[model samples]
Target: MNQTAGLAVGHYILLKDPITGNPLAGNPRKIENIDVATRTVTWGTAYAPVNVTMNAVKVLFHNAAFETFGRVDSGGYLTLADQAAPEGSPANAAWLWSDGTSRALRVRTKDGITSSLNNGGTGTVAMGDTDRTPAASVHQCGVIVTTGTLTSHRLLTLPPATDTDAYGKWIDNTCTGAFSVVVRQSTGATVSVPNGAKAYVWLDSRGVTKLM
Candidate 1:
């Protein structure tokens, strides 16, 4: 599907007839062999020597493979060959590049704002506490659970704030089937919870994916 042409210098053009200045689409142009001893180009036909030299003529053609990564893919895309391999080939590694290496997670660009690969089933994504708002402020924090009953997950009250809307990143994941969270207080050496109060559970990643 591609055509190409190259010149080795001091050679007659292959497709142009010198006498008529017409395209040699179907005709042939003769190029005399170089005389190494005289260091000169000779012409076999009636025309004079063209006096061709390096950079004298421009090369033209379609090179689909020039943009190809190491001639591996005809299409332009970054493949394994375009990157360096890891120190050792690990069993957990997938998505191998041509360089004989692997990675657990790879971020393609520094300016890209999002992570594309999601955990297999469910996982947690948390924004920092400085950005949290309580009156349905849209930035709700939660965990994505994929296994055992959800009752075990507990949400402790957001830590008491000296500043308004203050938050913390600590979350707990140890509860069972549809239930509520509880606040516990320590009295000297003993701990107790007040009666009949609904609690909110913190969120956590269930560790269901092996991204390496």
Candidate 2:
């Protein structure tokens, strides 16, 4: 008889029933594959219910980026590291970020640095820069007017509607005018008054000279 025609249907038994001496079915479903070298058939199934196959799996090491490493909490924010300019940069030339953009910042040759902390109507700043080193400056406000001998420029602030008496005094300085006030300083110290740096004053008379 012809070998192909003489072949009979064969059944495969996967798992053996614990109680009955019968071959279990259902799982290890029917599968077929042809082996070219040995010219044989091979098939198998998952060890458990969920069958998974792996064909083109690619694992890349050192190719992953950290996400949310320094995530800000509900009432927190992200912080940036300190940065400095290379050697030889004009002492007056510093880095400043106006809004969200950074650019070359400079003070007048006659002016020093006048860093101020003022709260605009938006309660936000328009510029800032930091110098980190043996003396790490986390935050420096006001204008950086490092020009000549001075360290900063005039820090001008505006007072709230209160303090009609004090407000008038600032206007008389010729240095003060309009709805704003100017606080000039020598070093980090206030020009004349203690802690009287420039700012937009906005507190009750009982409080210290308010800085805007």
Model 1 agreement with the true structure over 1-212: per-residue lDDT tens digits: 01123433334444344456455442222345555555544333333334444323222322222332344356775443354533343333343233323332232221221122223212332312122122211112222222223323333232232233322222232333454333221111111112222223322222111111
Off by over 4 Å in 2: 1-74, 86-212
Q: Which residues of candidate 1, in runs, are more than 4 Å off?
A: 1-56, 66-82, 85-101, 110-124, 128-212
Give candidate 1's whole-model lDDT. 0.30
Name the weakest run of 10 consecutive residues (lDDT summed) in model 1: 184-193
- Give Cα distance to truth, residue 76, candidate 2, Å: 2.8
Candidate 2, residue 121: lDDT: 11
Best by lDDT: 1
